[model samples]
Every structure is written in structure tokens, then in C-alpha cells.
Target: MTLLSTLNDDMKQAMKAKEKDVLQVIRMIKASLQNEQIKLGRELTEEEDLTILAREMKQRRDSLAEFEKAHRDDLVEKVKIEIAIVERYLPAQLTEDEIRQIVLQAIEQTNATSSQSFGPVMGLVMPKVKGKADGALVNAVVKELLNNL
Candidate 1:
């Protein structure tokens, strides 16, 4: 099944099982997907769905950080659970070493010798890494590789 269909199936299961937290998270994802579909006037491709999932995951992570800083362990735990749910829908994340290797390859392909080539290098690399890696992490790896060149 497609990712979207899997989500729909899981939502039905969650409802049947009376899994409130899981149901809530699934509803949030569905709402976001629906909103994006409306905005674009088309059903989302797998790539677009992954992008939305990543964005939701990022939002949860950011909320987790804030909750941590506020010492609200209860909220932190909730956000963590939400993050876990969101992560289940994302592509397997690329490790730092893997990202670095990809960045190196992008630099080579772009013939980017310095930071001045950041834009072109990112343009080339982001598409390859999208939905499989976090943007901030990829940017750091690219900068490190370019600086070392």
C-alpha cells in the first residue's frame, strides 16, 4: 500500500482499538495532508507526503525542546510520543557519515571549492537527500566539507 493508504488503515485500527493518542496523531497528520492537498489542488505524491511528515516531525522536535527548557516533563513526554509517531512515516534518516559522503560528492559534482558555492551545492544536494535527511544537518555537513576544501 502507499504511505497514505497505510496511514488511513492505521487510523481505522487506532479508532477500533480506542488508542486516543495514536488516533490524535494520525488525525493531525491527515489534516495536514488534506490541507496540503487543498493548497496544491491535487493529491500528494509520496515525495510530497514525506515532506509534510518531515515538517510535522520538525515541529514536534522544536516543541519538545521548548517543553524541556520549561521543565514541563509532562509536555515533553507527549511531544516525544508525537515525534515518534511522525517519524514512523518518514524515510529512514541518513546518518551523519552518510550525509557527509553525499555532501562531498555534491561538492565534487558542483566543483564547489569554497563557501561561495553554498547555494549551488545545496541546490544539487538537497534534492538527493530530501526526506531522507534533515536540512540543518545536511547544511552543516556541506559547510564543513566546503570549509575543509
Candidate 2:
């Protein structure tokens, strides 16, 4: 099933099971998906759905980091759970090693021998890794590789 339908089914199950946290997260996902559809005036593709899920996961991770810095363990734990729930709908993420390999290839393809080529290299790489890798991780890898050149 598509992520949207799976999410809808899970939402209903969460409600029936009285899983408040899970239901709340699912509702948030549904709302985001619906809003995107309305904004674009079309239904989302699977890739688009994955992109939205990734964005939600990224937001939760950012919140988790801030909560940790503030020593808010309760809020941190809640955000961690929310991140896990959002992750259920995303594709398997690329490992750092995998991302590095792709970045290396992009660098070669773009003939990017220095940090000056960061923009072109990233433009070439992001599309290949989008939705499957974190932008921060990709950026770091690109920077490290370019510095070594």
C-alpha cells in the first residue's frame, strides 16, 4: 500500500487501540500530506510523500537536539518517539559510507577539485541522494572530500 493509505489505516488502528501518542503523530503526518496536496493542487507521488516524511523526521530531530540542550528529558523522549513514528513511512536511509561513496563519485563527475566546486557538486549529488540521505550529512561529506582535494 502507498504510505498515505498505510498511514490512514494505522491512524484508525491507533484510534481503536487508544494509542494517543501514535494517533497524534499520525494525524500530524496526515495534515502535512493534505496541506501539501492543497498547496500543489495535486495528489503527492510516493517520492513526494517520502520527502514530506523526511522533513517531519528532520524537524523532530532538530527539536530533540534543542530539548537535549535544555535538559528537558521528558520532551526529548517524546520527540524521539515521534521521530520513530515518522520514520516508519520513510525509505531506508543511506549510510554515511554509502553517502561518501556517492559524494566521491559526484566530485569526480563534476571535476570538483576544491571547495569552490561545492555548489556544483552538491547540485549534482543532492538529486541522487535526496529523500534517502540527510542534507547535513551530505554537506559534511562533500566539505570533507573537497578539503582533501
CA lDDT of each candidate? 0.89, 0.91
Q: Which stretches of candidate 1 lie over 4 Å from their true place?
A: none
Model 2 agreement with the true structure over 6-38: per-residue lDDT tens digits: 989999999999999999999999999999999
RMSD of 2: 1.0
lDDT (Cα, tens digit) per residue for candidate 1, span 1-149: 77768889999999999999999999999899999999999989988988888888888888988999999999999998988888888888999999988888888899998899999999988988888998989988888888988
Poorest 10 consecutive residues by lDDT, candidate 1? 1-10
Question: Any idea what lDDT model 1 has?
Answer: 0.89
lDDT of 1 at 53: 86
Clashes of 1: 0
What does candidate 2 score on TM? 0.96
**Model 1 residue 46 distance off true place after TM-score fit, in angstroms:** 1.3
